[model samples]
Target: MTWGDGDGFVTCELGHKHWGRYGAAGLLPYHDGYVLLQHRAKVTIGGGTWGAFGGARRRGEDPVAAALRETAEESTLDASEVTLRGLMHEDHGGWSYDTVIATAPALLEVRPASWESKGAAWVPVDEVAEHNLFEPFAKAWPRLRQALRRPVLVVDGANVMGSRADGWWRDRAGASARLRDQLGAVDRYTGIAPFDVAIPEKVLVVEGKARNIGPGDTDVRVVSAEADGDDKIVETAASIVAEGPDVLCLVVTADRELRRRCVAVGAEVTGPRWLLNQIAPKAVDTPG
Candidate 1:
């Protein structure tokens, strides 16, 4: 076998030899209660067993990027076809393996693209445990299954902007537009709870003068309130939660009444400060 960068093995603090000099990462793509699993070739270590498509992380590579690259090299699906959802990390002392959880819009056709794989199949979630799985993957499956739910981040534009003393009151529409554009630049969000890492479906609610602002460059959906912003925020959270129990909603607002209303409908509530810290870490004087 040709030794490439991150190809060699290293012993972790746990005294186990593992592939990749830095660390390893894998992709777990799921859709409609099924997950894409790779069948290992007989020549590989876990021969004839099923696991995720993955390998060692390259120098200076992000874990998610490594996972996507390895998956593309070993499978027929491209990174563009899947949307990142969350991340789960397993650290074996100094060594580690990162699992990037993603969602496919639909179950597109997939098969083994490299010799390392014997085949590939979309296995049902419940039936996954019946197969002889790779040892590491098997151990991680339980937690991974629990985290399959997608995250929805609901932003209270009026509340969040009001909390900031950045002259938002002077130009409400301009401020909303700025916030929308800034949210577009954010690539990932650290999960609040019940989620390890979150790449959420962002929703921003605007009312009054800011209602004219539309969707920005990012995935953020701007919802213009017909009436009260607080009422719209609560409705949005309720609508999202109603999609499924697996859909996690986190509403950002400092309004106690709004928080109580959102929480009543199975949505998690956080203050505006939590969001300010994410979008504008440098901005000071942000009040909850």
Candidate 2:
């Protein structure tokens, strides 16, 4: 109920002690082939070992905000320097430590700015294990490394809108906006993907009348295609995959030709059914 009320130690079901009364979180800032790591102060738990920038969450703080706040306090970087991709959780019975794996638009200079952090550096993914690592982090590194790339889901606004029998054709922009709002819930929906994922990046490509659906604060990003929606979707996916980072680009649509083009450029294709099905309970017209 007060600031830092989540601070302090508690043992997990496995009889191992962990910091934070509430679950803790860490910010994993990644760019290119490197990820930021912080060397812990010798006086702290798992001292002198390297891990992500993070610590105790304050009372009522969400994991992502906590991670970012901790990262800012422990390092010279600010929240503006990174874009959050998704959250990954390491559960220990009732306790858990969530990792906020984010994508940095570009690598920024970093330095240890707090006593809790002894040093900071951007370590190449392959060299992470060579450093003295926090025990828990060492164990989680391999699996986490396998998922370092961000996933982007490019939705065909028209295609998904058409799939529904709602009176969408009469109001394409409203339908597109409705679809965009519904997509914000996708991050909380699970079990559809084959593997665990951080929240994937979502891009909604709208054309024709729906093209009027401009950008706003919705979880879904609207890209008004200057021409064909399919071409724009494919181009967007191709540009993302071409970045050369470990990334998954999924163009959401049932159009066979669009699917072929997207997949041809190292992207994946999924029908609108998967997304619509997952967010069904929220109702397409309902705000996310």
Candidate 3:
């Protein structure tokens, strides 16, 4: 109810003590072959140790926001400079720590901005294990490192919308709008190939009558396609692939031609089930 009311400590189901009543989150900033890490001050918990910049979540804050805010508070890196890829969650029954992984390219400047951190540096991915790291972070590093590359999930809106036999045929625009809203709240779920778990930057490609469902500040970006939704989805995936070989581009659709086109451009493909399994609870049935 109140902002930052989640201050203080709480015990997890494991009987282990942890900070943050609403749970904690951290930002793992990766660039090129390196990941930015923070060293705890001698006066702080697990002092003189290295880990990602982060802290407790506020009462109403999402994990992503909490991660970004905490990193901003502890480091001089500009939040806008980073592009969040996805999150890796460590659940301890009721309480959990979500690590939001993002990228800012190579050689971006980052400095320690708070007393909680004694120092900051960019450590190579392969060398992260060589350094003395915080216990929890050390445990999660193996899985986190595999997801260093941020992915772009370009969706075939019409195709995905058509997959559900929920009366979308009657009102295409309204159905697309409903689908977009549900996608905004989706979490967890592995994105595509090479990424064991992730939440990609979602781009919903809508065309025809659904084209009017335009941009917003929601979790999903509505891209009203000028022509075919399938073409736009493939184009979006190609553009992301153009960013770099390391950048992941996954297209969500079962359309054979579209899937082939996306794969032709060095992108991965998955059916609607890949998304529906995660967002189905959020997608309300079309009223009869």
Candidate 4:
């Protein structure tokens, strides 16, 4: 229907049907390197256990929106104060729930504001393993750790092509194909580039004719759509920042407006050269 319209539920016949009937969202709030977790009330399922703040998604709400809403309802923290990281997992089967991970700039003073939680507080990065944690969260924790450190890279293919001085307009398909092949090769050959810290996610957005260029077998995820790639990139970045606390999003483009929009939402911006530099190979030996 529309944004906020109630979509029907989806069910699976898997064993141990749990957390079904309603979709769910969660806030993996963070500050610095630490994360905020909630302890469920003793009477609740998986109660007296530490987990991210989350609950059933409301009809008409996307997972990220539902997550922020749930976090506010379950804890005293305001939803607007947090940044989304991205979708960590979509646990489907007998019960389906999307885990929306996010981060905050500060260690919020969290307390149970509703019946779902008994206590809420920040857990140090090193101490996450000490607590009795929910099973799904525990199983996903290692992957999540890696994901949180990865940064989403949003590229403006059109802008980047223009920068190449290759007359892409005369051969849009060829230019796009060359770019995609280069990117794929970069993914295959580049050693994990050192980041100040590890990055857990890398995404590339392509639009127009370039949209047809897929990510191929690369490790990076690609979003190719007819829509404004800049807008799509912004939305993706915003979603990730909202759901995962440890992740960062860096949009690559020269578009002033798009850059501004992303920065306003707590995402970082880089120029097209950053991506081009990655694919540029170093000088090779020409020995006889």
Off by over 4 Å in 3: 1-11, 15-17, 58-61, 170-199, 206-236, 273-287
Candidate 3 lands at a TM-score of 0.77
* lDDT scores in order: 0.87, 0.82, 0.83, 0.66
Candidate order, lDDT descending = 1, 3, 2, 4
Ranking by TM-score: 1, 2, 3, 4
Indicate the residue-level lDDT of 122 in model 2: 91
Better of 2 and 4 by TM-score: 2
* Global lDDT of model 1: 0.87
lDDT of 2 by residue, 172-275 (tens): 88988888888865574343242254578788899998887776667677888988788898888899899775787778899999899999999988888777
Which portions of model 4 miss their true places by more than 4 Å? 1-12, 150-159, 163-288
Off by over 4 Å in 1: 1-4, 286-288
How many Å off is the CA of 7 in candidate 1? 1.3
Per-model TM-score on C-alpha atoms: 0.93, 0.86, 0.77, 0.54
Clashes of each: 0, 1, 0, 25
Please give the range of 10 consecutive residues that has the lowest summed lDDT in model 3.
279-288
Tens-place lDDT digits, model 3, residues 1-288: 123777788999998888889999999989888899999889877899999999999887898899999888988989888877778888897578989888885657788888888889999899999988998899989989878887877778898888887789999998888788777776555646444457677889999999988755478888888876677787788888998866888788998988899999999988887687777843434434
TM-score of 1: 0.93
